[model samples]
Target: MSLAVALALGTALALPAVAFADADDSDNLMRKKRFGQNTGTVTTNSNTGGHSQESGSKATTETAVISDGAITPFITADGAAAMQAVADKYAAVVAQGGWPKVPSGKLKKGSTGKGPAALNKRLFMEGYLRAEATEGEYAQVFTSATEDALRRFQRNHGLSVTGVIDGPTLGALNVPADRRLATIKANIPRLAEYSKDIGNRYIVVNIPAQQIEAVNDGKVYSLHNAIVGRPSRPTPVVMTPLTVIRFNPYWNAPASIVEKDIVPRMTSSGASKVMRDMNMKIFNGVGGPEIDPDSVNWRRAVVDNYHFRQEPGGSNAMATAKIEFNSPFGIYLHDTPEPHLFHTGSRFYSSGCVRVDKVAILIDWILQGQDGINSSRIAELAETKERLDKPVTNSPQLRVAYLTSWPTRDGVAAFRSDVYQLDGTGFVVGQPLPVGETQGGKRYVLKPIPRSLEAVDADEAVGFASIFRRSSDRIDASERLPGASSKSTDSLVSLKDPKAKLKAQGRDTGKKKSKAASNGKTRAWTGNRERSASEVMSMPDADGTTAKKPGSKKVASKKAKSGDKSKTAKAKADEKAKTTKSTKVVKKDKTEVAAKKPDAKAVTDKKKALTDATKTASADSKSATQKSNTAKAAKPADCKAGADGKLPAGCKPAAAAKKPPAKPEKTAATPAKTASSTN
Candidate 1:
């Protein structure tokens, strides 16, 4: 048999098994019945000639199952073929060295340059431009044909079809062909995996591309720009069924927002202002009493005690509607108050919920066959601005996926920015993605992950308290304050001791004095007695003790003693000369003089008198030394001793030696008698 015939027979054989398998599960059968699956299943009966016969027939269908929970077969055979065709085309391009990169610059209609030439060549390679269009030199010009081709390429890639080659266009054009091929190869498994058991109608959200598409019978019914969560608060990947559509929905701000955004603003701007501005009402707790904003301490209530709910209005965070689905992450799709955010190429601004453009259209699409929910009814409800909850009889499956690269209808692989860095490819954190990409088109930079704003603000408010806390509180309990000299109980003991009080006061005074005295020059007293004596002598005594001038008397006595000695020596020399001149007469005179000279006893007594005078002088000097020793011993004990054991300044030394040794009176007669006896 032919290949086509064999495939047809295989499909025919597979249909009954799928129908039976679905029938085997009562839940699946009920779901299918609710979704109006296999509506062609019919039974017929006819009776003729008293005989009865029955005939039954059923219709078969194919579906795609992208994930475990997804029941819809959104990808049909044609869709799979189209995707595979694009992949195959890119694989061939990879083999042919891929499309050449356009020069890095902006190129639009009426601009002619090498950039336009390269762009045209690339578009031609990718099948946007026809072969015959690349013939002439004017082909390089940004002509209408080139503009049309560019627009077609942009439309296929989910970019703004401006026909202008902006930065994002250039970035897309510059991606290496090998990388494009790798993306196609990487996604082939996903395409195949999703090619089975999908529902008849479902929603597909491309997280990386920030776009959402509603598919029915393998064809796109609605397309919308999606504002997913920021990188720090990424939209979670999920596959589940959405069963309810809420009109003019009340938005209960998530705990994250209450703690991070609301509480801090409340603390800074006050509860009343924030509450009024946000159009929010505070509740005692979840489903509890309605509390006035002024009734509670916002700083404490925001942390764990209160819940915030914004009344339904145009200014509400959830603009006008919300689509609820079953997922562990509590994520859902809704409309946004800031509709302008949808105009940008990259829409990633929500905390974690997805904000869809023209969400009313999406809602209409989701509630097509459900009772009391149609395009006109939805429009009327939205105009009324009243809260309404509409239940969907047959819910549609939703699949949120991270697909940075995918095949476009024009047989080219379109690449988007890895906004969440989910692909494991290295990229700058905050750098905007290329134009025509998902995240960085209009200067949207990545921000840090949000923490509890109330926690941060509270900490700042208590910063001063933390600063002034005692050492034990700030550091450890065992650690005392620096230089805490006494225990708490010591205050009473210190009061009872006068000496202790004085010592404490002295310590305090000494500290102050040391600080004050450091600024002046200090003179330390050394123990040099000579310098001390000089200083003492220089000053006039108040008592008349130093008035007599002791040094003058000592000098005079010394002069008189030297004068007497000199006279005696001169007289002896004269007597000797006279004895030499007249020998006999001199001899008779010498004998008479010698006889007149004192006897030995008298000479010995004179010697004894001289020894006594010498002994008396020595005794006077010793007595003066004893007096100095006694004075030194009597010095105050508090006086600091110097290096030589002398007292410090403010103490006096012993009085000067009482008197110089008394000088013996001059003895002229005795010297003459001695000279005559020697002659």
Candidate 2:
């Protein structure tokens, strides 16, 4: 018995996961999700056996409890009708003043609030709770039932299903009822467009949700996660028929990619390197003449309208198969080598095509009715890397749409992030600048400081002239005015006048002193004034000019006797002579400065020219390179930090944000149709 049980368990582990279909259509709440829900166990298979089918609401089992994980195709007539009803209910809720804001804090199992008797009505009022909570007042107490309800709410909003309250949950729960109603109504038109001409068996690639749905007979047959085009290079919405399946396909570069991407890269990385890395060959036209990559100018190629064809292999962009369709947008479903991006919450990274995660399994499902094409044969062909094409005889009608809000079949509305800012909902996913462009910045050259000599020389000369003038005045007052009884000095005693000589003869000096004293008499003086040694030294020095002192005071008793001239007479002569010499020296400096003026001017002009050249070079570098400012503390509101305190991806500088969007990729002309269709 033990051996038998071990064998059965091993078989269960090895066997591929098969879809467990529900008996009743309404109990669609699934315990697992296969279409990239943030939570829940995802089971994927490459087998051709069956697919998972569960989509409707957050709760649906017999117990009518909220079941967290479920996969549902988003766009359909039934979903549209269901959402219209959802819109009405929301309008009524808005009219009645909407739901209460959930208390902001940690709320999980075992948490407590007011008792259950008063009716814990927080999430219930927001259409989250189907039945009454058994816990505290107004469902304020965190319990298992409350946790499940919270997870369902989070999942429906395209958020990670962490049972406790988070930044995103509070934001969604508190959205005004009127706004929510408006968002629903705004999305109704797109849903209505999807509803028309959609047959019972069809395929949907909802761009906002980033998930692909294969529906048959009004039910979800399988769901696969998908990566769609970015907002800048948005995937076009279209309705077409899945025509042919091309395996081991060659990827022809679109005109937009050639001009916007490959050409620009070739400018920096050389044409040969890019061609070798991408495994591409340049052709004169689609199937015209072959040209060597080294001989072709990549930029000129874009103008000449040359084509780029990537060979088929592991490095090929289309890994396994290509689902051909009829459209002008040049967008179709294909497989990718970088499958890890399928798990990303925002899978808006492609140029224009839809990249399916489990593409082989989907192909196997679509090719079932065709002869000689099966899972085993697909593996065989992929191993050999052989090119092949099979027509899809009963191919399902395909649609690519952008629906941010849709109601599941059971009336519980599910929402997706408005990645493209469609639905008129103000919310959008951002694309930040590359880290190398902002964080790991380029270095800029520093310009040198300028120094001019002309201004400095002129200022020094003027300063020296002023000093000499002040010194001369002080010396003159001390020598020439000391003998006067009032403020007046001798009429001929001018320090600035070269004509004033201090020589005085015997009788003339006496007559002059007596006459000047009599005429200048206003204030009274007692005795002959004398100069102290300290006063002589305290006067400001002229550096290169004369400093004169008063004559030694004569003895009062030994007044001027017979021909011995008074000592003051001799001192006056020396001062007048020195002042004249200093004035002459100043005039000589003025002449010398004037002679050097041209040289100083030339030095200043050269300095200015060097500075201007340096500034011009700095400006050129700024234009050529994308430099970063590491000192910025605040960010633009469009690229603000998130919960992790880091900038969201796709945030560029304000100058970069104004640039026009990426060019749309051109579609290849539809390949000629064929017969002998496959599954």
Highest lDDT against the true fold, candidate: 1
TM-score of each predicted structure versus truth: 0.50, 0.53
Residue 66, candidate 1: alpha-carbon lDDT: 20
* C-alpha lDDT of candidate 2 relative to the true structure: 0.53
lDDT of each: 0.55, 0.53
What 10-residue stretch in candidate 2 is worst by lDDT?
A: 670-679
Question: How do the residues 1-679 of candidate 1 rate in per-residue lDDT, one tens digit apiece?
Answer: 4222322232322211001110011111112111111112112111100010011021011111122222212234344466678777777877998888798777889988787888888988878888766668776788899998886666444455568987656766777877766665655544444433457788877676676767776655655657677764566555556767888877776665565456656655567777777677877767789876655544334344566777776366665788776544556787766655555655566666677777776777677747867767776776677788876777877776556655554456555566665453322122223222232112222332223544445333333333444545422211122322222222322656776675545554324344333312222121111122223343333232332323545545655655665565566667667655753334545634543444577667666665666566667767877997987798776676678999777776546776554333323334445444434
Scored by TM-score, the top model is 2
Model 2 residue runs over 4 Å out of place are: 1-71, 114-120, 134-138, 425-679
Per-candidate clashes come to: 14, 17
